[model samples]
Target: MIGIDMKLETLVNNGPAVIFLCRAETGWPVETVTANIVRFGYSPEDFISGGLRYADIIYPADLEIAVSKFSAYVEKDYRGKDPDCKVEYGEYKGEAGGHKRNAKGNLGKGRGGYDSFTQQYRFLNKSGNVLWVEAEIKVLEEEEGKACLFQVTVFDISRWKHTEKTMPSALDTENELKRIINSGHVIVFLWRAEPGWPVDFVSENISELGYTPEDFTSGSIFYTDIIHPDDLDNVRAEVSKNTEGGRDYFSKEYRILAKSGEVRYVDERTLIRRNEKGEITCYQGILLDITQRKKAEVAQRLNASRLEALVKLDQMAGASLKEITDFAREEAVRLTGSKLGYLAFMDAYESTLVMHSWSDSAMEECSIEDKQFIYPVKSMGLWGEAVRQRKPIITNDYPAPNLLKKGYPKNHVHLIRHLNIPVFDGKRIVAVAGVGNKEENYDESDVRQLTLLMQGMWQLIQRKQLEEALRTYSGELSRANEELRSVNMMKTEFVEEMRFPERAEYGEIMDYETLYAIDSQQQKAVNTFIHYSEKLRRLVDSLLYQSLEKAGKIDYSFEGMQLKDVLSDAFLNNVFLIGEKALEVEKEVPASLPEIRGDREKLTALFTALVDHAIKFTPQGGKLALEVKEGADNVHIVIADSGKGISKELIPYLFDRLYQVNDSVTRRYQGLESGLYICKNIVDAHKGEIWFESEEGLGNLMHVKLPK
Candidate 1:
């Protein structure tokens, strides 16, 4: 490059050198400049004398054409000609030889290659021989400052040109290979036979595989050392299957454990063969990844499982109610690995889920309507949205950020995942189920499971509710019959008692106290039997009247009622046992617990049962306290006692019929276990919940949360 630039300067400074431009059209310089030609040589001079007409000069033969092109460009205006024009130049071999040097050759001590100050066109002289010389010129500049012609400064460039032919060194070749491999191709490896057979190095471009020659020192290395354990078996099996007489040509998938312990799976293609001497020769291969392919397979399975779940939901249509409900949850949990689940059916009023269940050790017996375990539909929550839209929804984690930002409680965050699904009976959502805390959180599996769960629930809940209604009615009748029989026996026995004579010494201790004990025993039997009958009779009456009123056959509203007046009637109906147990009562009504729409007979049955329960459980000296508190649209009625407190376990099942304490002989309470169940049934019928808190030896506090 230095020689070329210096040569340009030399041409410009040389004394009077002829210079001309080559033109494609006219083919010669009209006027030209020159100096002596002897030094530069006529051969090279004649090469530049004419301009291009294309046969050859520097092109090896057409010397006169180059001269013609130069003279034509010098004379033409070229003002509006094409901006892109071609220029041709030439210099002869003999004249150029003076400036040439061997770049790869040793020079004399303290000496460096000389620079060329000039170069010219290579052309054939008048003698028809190639020659070289210098030339220079400048073109006129336009007002726009664009040059119409190029300035030409020519000198011999043969010496510099000679250096371009020398071969590149070994270092250059290695660097070139490095560049190629860095572009991301090239596989390298080493293998041995019998764990040590002078390492056979393999590389697509072996010399560029990057290890220096010193790396091969000592003994050959075993390739098996780099195979990851999990992939080693594959590698070995593949190699063995294709190997015979210590030779194999095979392909297999295996993982290579890099120095950093990252195992990269690779598809290795090998080429192996034995030499004629029966000696093993080569094990070679290329490696590629197939991880994405594996992921695609998993995705395919997930899609199939999802489709299967959808089909099952359709097949089970109109199936047994219990079977369908059960199948729904089974498939749901299986799909999502959900630890807890529920399915609920909303009541006609669309106010609540009348039937519900979930999977929770802490709440096995709790209802979906229970506040501690289920979301409420009217509560402006995920549950509300699920039902309102009649769709399936999933919450990967609870204490939902958007819901929380909109005012949900933070305690729910610990609940992990949550899902809410609606079951549409028709145009409206009549059922719902919220499965929570998915083992794998919400994913395609979960969405699929929930879809089927909801679909199944929608079909069964609609008809199942009708079946439950008939069962409830049948149970009510059986209870009524039993109570009526006991009531008749009591009436007969009371009359029989009236006719009995006081014997001389049936009990020598014939005093008022003793007399009271006898009367207590008899009164208990009479009161219990009578009270039970009356309550059952009233329940039957309510059921009958409500049915009629619902069908528009009766007017159910009362004339007017006072809260205390209603309670007093309820208290009177159960007073028969009050005297028998000798229990003391405390009543406090502050007007907060308002009287609301309800049947007098139903409240009577509710009150009578509660009072009966208090008396049966109280110790002789204990008392039952009845209290009330008012809220805006509802009331709270509390019945508390100083009796032995209920066990934590028993309290939860208090309202379940036939649930009696097996240790009753030790605890010593009277009455069948159905008393609380009756009380709970009445309260529930009135849109209320009977809640209680108790601990052994501390006493019990019962709360009847009633909606006004």
Candidate 2:
């Protein structure tokens, strides 16, 4: 019996399966495994010593599924048995003890049982390599009626799985190839190397070109019949050159005529099939429809050409109307594949046409003794029909009888085909442009090109005309302005001279006061006269200063001066007004004020004007304040007044020349509206900034900052 057991162990070890016996436990801990486990890069001792369990070798992705199936089998088959019963293996039963199962549940078939089950899953070897395996598990029971062990046999099936994936059936391969071919735009062809390249076989997708494969295969049509006549010679030459050069393949692009009479572009790739004798036998090739791609290319080229022409017209900025029309007419001729062209401008009433320009070709070919430049629209020929009909007119057959045709001059150039379009400015037709003698025929494309070019030309002409008129008007305006300035200068000089006479009268009054003692009424009248004369003199002086400044004739004497000293001079100049107003004035000036580079007289005048303005606006007993501050780069002065402040809406225009808050004749103000304007000019001349802040019914604050 010992010798028989040794032989059985040897037989099992030499087989292709690995056997495992594990205690029925949570982790299914291995108690024994066949020595053949070494085939999976593992030693039997590794499992028997409890270092690795049978569940541990199962791939992580398949472990959950394998354990679930094992539990389900036990629950369904051994449900009524004792929980601690040891179910031991009895005999090798062929698939009757349990159902066959796999990790994917693809093999869940066979009769139900309580002792054994079979499954297939993936296992991880020692080196982490995945192995496809088939496992058969049996429940073993002990003599004490308890399930105590699990007997598992594993067989490697990795080679068989690999074969099933890499090799597919012939029918599947053929069907897949056919599906790809039918789903795309390529048409396959096989042709005999004979005259006209007779078609031997063609793909069913030839229907895309409005033809069937049977048409060519049945010899009812040859491949060469579908190629465009204009492109066939070139295609043949290319193929012949490649074949003579011993080339195996070649590609060519040409136009083909579809059965629906539409021209379609195709790109062909052909392979030459030859016999051992170096003679051509057949040709295998593919044809791809490229009609949309070809049309896009043509449209792109046309757009580029149109843009270039428009740019050229735009660059002729100062050209005359005739030069622009002549160049544009020639471009129309070139763009539309015509031999001669002409442009004519219409009058405002649309009653007459004035011929403006003709292409160089037209001018060179015509030998008419009298070429009319202007013609009445009431008695014109075919070209005038575009203007009369208010639309384009195309005559592809020029000699055909038509009611619009009129007799031409004896020596005029002959015409074959003609296209005419009206150029519209808004809803009115401004011009009519015509092109004639195209080689093929005039169509809508020619009409489009001619219309766009003429429209661009007319715009340039109008722009040049407008520019010329502007130049002439500008010259007249400049002359008028100079004359006005001369008259203004004379008036300013006359006002300046009046100041002398006014001073003489004031002196006369003063002399009489010292010489004689007058009555009280007389004294009062004399005082009133003196006051009115003084105000008149000041008004004259302000007018004179403003005129000189505007004419750019005022000279400034810039020198170093103390800001405080300038302020003191301004206060003294306005002492009388401040006294009359009874205004309380507060001044804050730094003891060590920095000197500033400025015009002293102008700066003093600037401050005097501001002080006088504040006095006029303030009530009889209002308050005024002046503060000077020293800054890092400038000296800032603030002059504030508690007066009836300026309205918010009127503040923006306060400093404008000749602008006043109260300008009506009945208003109380008694001076020209030039005080603040003059003050701003004076400050700006000294490189200083002046701005004001005020709110209605509140007070006003004026800030001045000068560079130190």
Candidate 3:
């Protein structure tokens, strides 16, 4: 509805681009106009194809707000509600024009990108480069064909992007890294896996590992070579995944051997890596000495095996539900350095107690509804309040201030006690333990000591959480893996479905494209399976390495990720190629994708495959868009192109890993067909997915999903 070609002409050199706009909901004409903008070369194809659809461009997080805001306004019809309810959003740049040039009008990248189109928005045009934008939106109405029509105008603010054109001075970033390591007794070294992660750096403190930096950096210092042979595989896997995905916000913890040949515990803190082409590399993690912390944990653990002060403590283990209560009743007199104690098991709703363990030596247990022992929040008693707050509480004074309704049994007053700690299983507070009644009732020191014991008590909790996370991620990964496997198995089945030679009546085998699809499907499926399997392996390894790292057992390199290099090559190769379109390449192409600890070769192959397609489908003057966005653990590269859209019948085939679009050269334009196939493989290898949305005549949007 609003003219944009002139504005796109003025914004090319400011920086990479991101487009935004509000469009009329009128019908096919709007769609046609959008397609024309893309075809005529005003915006990148991917930009137009993906976001132009109604409400599709909204980020996952923004959708609800965008929807709610719009719905509320439409209901009011701008009469009774907030006018500020105007949709505020950025626009996807218009397609570049057929014969466009740089701001200088030099024979350069396609027509330029867009300029500001509204107070809150502008259109993003990358020419032929990658750019991204984040914005809000509003709606407008106007006359169309003698009737009122609704439209949305998008705003693009891509020029503000902080593009990383160069790496930070290595000395500075590295020195800060060294300062952190030297201040602690932690040993650090990079780990490199042949046919796997390769470590290229280590701290001088590695000498504590019985090896100097030189020895560590050399073949003689190979981490895998020194890793406790039993943990080598796990460590390798975890580190690989971490390195591949951006590890900034993630934590890694594990154990390793010191140069003195002694087993040492460690903790590692992560620092982020920033790279050119805007990929957030894996964390440049540094190790800290956690040996003392480890020893303390060990000592605490050993104490659990036997408690000397309480004669019957050893018998507490494996006690039946009834026996457990019986033990608590009998042993409560001495177990907590107190003459009296009690334990209460709360019901599932935490609304009431189902069971109680009280001191036999004590005169009596409080009633369930008594203000002293129940209605956790309503009771001011130390025990009830602690359970309510879900934290430990301490009181050294008998009937302290608000304790127990300010009343106490004449004899019970002697049991000036303290402490109520919630025993949690997952998020639920299943039980509460109260320690009390002694000649020398609990005080600050006792409270402190007991809280330390909570750690061991919570070990089971950590184990449960770990088990759950593993189960969830594993199940999701398994399901996805199974689906891919099914596709592969189906490929074998496809051959059987074929009417071979004279055996069938489909006569001459339907079409070459059909047969080609069958053949390509096999390769695509198999390759895709292998690719994703490799990624799964990497993710598992990365997680492990992170575990080992956070545990202070390893210091792995963060630079081998090579995301920039891979994405760049892939974006240019065929994924974004316009073939012989003589389509001008605009937008800035940073030297490459940022390098990190991922499988470089694999990522590179992925980009190559996608770029090949971008080029193939795009006609002369058609635009292809590749946008790269980074996070703490992964890099997201989106490759969008303007070309004959994918038909409804082709989506399944598209993901059919090895299958290309060209089943028959005469019938399909997807050339070197394996571009999508290869892209899928590469993405899967990197623990990512490949997906797109398109229609006949409309352009296509191909998303290359990869972990950082």
Estimated TM-score per prediction?
A: 0.31, 0.37, 0.27
Candidate 2 lDDT over 186-287, as tens digits, reads 999999999899999888888898999899999999999999999999999998988876556789999988887668999999988878565789999999
Task: Give the poorly placed runs of model 2, Cα more than 4 Å off.
Answer: 1-237, 256-264, 282-289, 336-340, 361-375, 394-402, 407-418, 436-449, 475-708
Question: What do the candidate models score in CA lDDT, each in turn?
Answer: 0.52, 0.75, 0.49
**lDDT score at residue 459, model 1, on the 0-100 scale:** 40
lDDT of 1: 0.52
TM-score, model 2 to reference = 0.37
After superposition, the stretches of candidate 1 with alpha carbons farther than 4 Å from their true spots are 1-223, 226-231, 245-281, 284-582, 590-592, 595-617, 620-622, 632-634, 646-698, 704-708
Q: Write the per-residue lDDT of candidate 1 for residues 248-347, one digit (tens) a residue.
A: 4567776665444444556677656456554556565555555456546645776677578667766765576666776676556555656666676564
The best-first sequence of candidates by TM-score reads: 2, 1, 3
Cand. 3 TM to true fold: 0.27
Badly placed stretches (over 4 Å) of model 3 are 1-334, 339-366, 369-392, 403-415, 421-434, 468-539, 556-708
TM-score of 1: 0.31
- At residue 189, what lDDT does model 2 achieve? 93
Worst 10 residues of 1 by lDDT: 663-672
Residues 598-635, candidate 3: write the lDDT tens digits: 56665665566566555656777878776776656666
True-structure lDDT of candidate 3: 0.49
